[model samples]
Target: RSPSYLAAQGCWPGRRLQGSPALSPFLSKCGTFPPESCFFSLICSLGSFMVMLVGLLRYAHVIECCGPSLLNTLGLAAGWICAAGLTMVGNFQVDYAKVLHYIGAGVAFPTSMLFVFLQSVLTYRMAKTRGHYWTGHLRSILSALAFITLVFSGVFFVQESFVLQHVAALCEWIFIINVLVFYGTFTFEFGAISTDTFLVLLKASQAPKSYKSDSSTASTPHGHSHSEGLAMV
Candidate 1:
């Protein structure tokens, strides 16, 4: 819908100025207008929320399977930050909030790449079966493709030529689609999750602060008990 609006206004792939510089038809550009901007904001906000939820679930799943670790913690942070960037990108139109929009783009792109890479590493580290190994291989390929496309998109976007700008936009679309596909891959692991997984996460989160000293004293045994109860999916 936003694309159609942009196309109607000759802003889908904007034209070059006769004597001035031209701007590429970025997805953000689609939200520069009135009605389309409304829809853009709505969609972006929803997507951002969904991304945050997915990140949380993934973090919880990892904790349930392998217990919490720095890598998983970093992955969770990266995912949430990426979601925040997406929220900024969607709510602030590039034409109106240029600085903030670019900032959002900067945060969203790199953090998303980081998220995928960390997830790929986690997949390999956690793999115990033939299927798990194949999943890791698939994730590695997606991560590599994401990195390449992201690099190309950034490189091409800064060029002075209109053709290069278009190429940048194409690369940007590919990068986004690739990331979405990577997220979809989580369905395989998610399918294995059980009620106990959620129960463990709930108990961990709800545990009283008064038990901190006791928990610390018995951390090793408690951790092993948790690991035994929360079987890997």
Candidate 2:
């Protein structure tokens, strides 16, 4: 399943329902809803961390393929921060530690956005260098959309009106969707990596010399060859 699907699973039927308040219903209160919201929180943490880790691992290929660049490094750093932030968010429940929750969220959200932007830039650069369209142009379009939605989300969040706040919430979800879709663009690259890795592992596991012959003769305590039949005489 897509990482986004995994993430949505963490929060579905719990909060942020259709035609609801601007803020996540859980965020509106001190504790989680249905008293089991922490479970979802944990899910979010795990899913988010997994997604970010995959993205980070993808960076090794990026670095190898694209060579070292400041943008790539920045994107990797941002991804690490995003993953750590997600872990923190999961570990610290909002109701239990509001300060810590906000801190974690603060780290996660902006860095997540930053990761998106840096990755988009890097992808665009790589596409241009390789003369590829999908990674460069298509990904650029998705990144642009994500950036726009994120801007709307941030803008609406600062507004005083409930309707605007709700709109902001909706935009936030849209931004997330864009980010998820953007990540999906890497499917081809990931598949290629998996295939190559599998082939390399298969080759490494197969031994050319299946069997070996003893190069030296074995001798018995009587100074006779063990492999030779003993003389009847």
Candidate 3:
């Protein structure tokens, strides 16, 4: 994601600017996805890098840091797909027509996410159940977005081919928003796991109020077992 690249694209002032996006220069926004998707790649890479760093500092942190894996993975993969599609389109280099590029952008981002979400819902279900249901719900929300964009794409495909050129811009804005939302969840989960670990350590490092506070002092075998189970859980 380079500013220079963006500057190059922006300087072009897409055909959509010529008339309404619906009746622009090119009909198919088909293009090769880039090596790097715009700023979105940088953000995704940075976020993943940070999570890896945190995992190194704490064990099991990666577990918390890694699932909803599908969405995160798809977000990253879609960036590449966009880059490829863009390349195939040439960003209007030979011909200043970008409807194909927009079409690709519109369909690729969310479609990839949908596949990713399906993977998450199916793959990460066990001890993760109560923990990650919301992840599935989020997937559903995005699935709805994908459906709408897909329908719009279909309309453009069949009726208004020119609109396909603009679909990428309008639809991809949602991709940006989706990235933000996913990051927010990632931050929350990281914080949750981190705080949970910190609290457990705080309790462990603190001296027991008195010798009787030790687990061995529990009145009955059942009491000691219950306390142990709580600690393990």
Candidate 4:
């Protein structure tokens, strides 16, 4: 399996997200074979919310380091809004809070699509500036796949046929899967930096160790620390 596939080890599949009667009136949320599958809605929603949080945190770190301008700031804000919207959707199920559920979906889906595009641009810029060719190419490809799938998802949203609904459901899943894949690619970016070591250092002083480490260890601007040995695997 691909690394991205492995990263989404426990996420719910595409079919789980297509249960609501409002979206697919013909299909039953509860399947006869398994019996009462409607609860998959909760699974899909919560899983998506968690995945979105990963995107928010990783991209925010990248922006903070590489994106210092007004545009990057706005992009980060949009990313946060997108994450919030996903959380809202998870909390407000369609059966309980129809208005709130749709509202959350409205905010989450579009913002997610927008965030991918913005991240793509950011990646392209970083590739040129920092000479990260493979990362940029991979992100660009994932962004394009996400946009295409999301577009199909939107186009099939208003269709009445079950066939169209099935296609739309698949498209939505592909879109989300691509988003998760893009987030997984951040491992490459993360590998380039010592953020993990710094994070350990930030808390290292609180730990039992009080002494500064030797020169062989990782070196900070101020000095060297034992945490430097903890490389960004």
lDDT (Cα, tens digit) per residue for candidate 1, span 1-233: 45566566565456533453344557887577779889988988998898888888888888888986799989999999999999899889888999999999899999999999999999998899999999999999999999999999999988978888888888888999999999999998888788887886787676666478677877989887889889763
Which portions of model 3 show Cα errors greater than 4 Å?
Answer: 1-107, 119-131, 161-176, 192-233
- Model 4 scores worst on lDDT over the 10 consecutive residues at 25-34
Sorted on TM-score, best first, the list reads 1, 2, 4, 3
Candidate with more favorable, higher lDDT: 3 or 4: 4
**Candidate 4 local lDDT, 1-233, one digit each (tens):** 23356336532333222332322321222221222333544555665666556554555555546644455555666767776777666566566676886787788888877776777777766665555776788788988888898889779978976678778778877887888787787776666555654454345334444344543244564343335545533
The estimated TM-scores of all candidates read: 0.81, 0.64, 0.37, 0.60
Clash totals for all candidate models: 0, 0, 21, 0
Q: Give me the candidate number with maximum TM-score.
A: 1
RMSD of each: 9.7, 12.5, 14.2, 14.3
Query: What TM-score does model 1 achieve against the real structure?
Result: 0.81
Candidate 2 clashes between residue pairs 3 or more apart in a chain or in different chains: none
Better of 1 and 4 by lDDT: 1
C-alpha lDDT (0 to 100) for residue 133 of candidate 2: 58
- The candidates, ranked best first by lDDT, are 1, 2, 4, 3
Model 4, backbone clash pairs (residues 3+ apart or across chains), number: 0
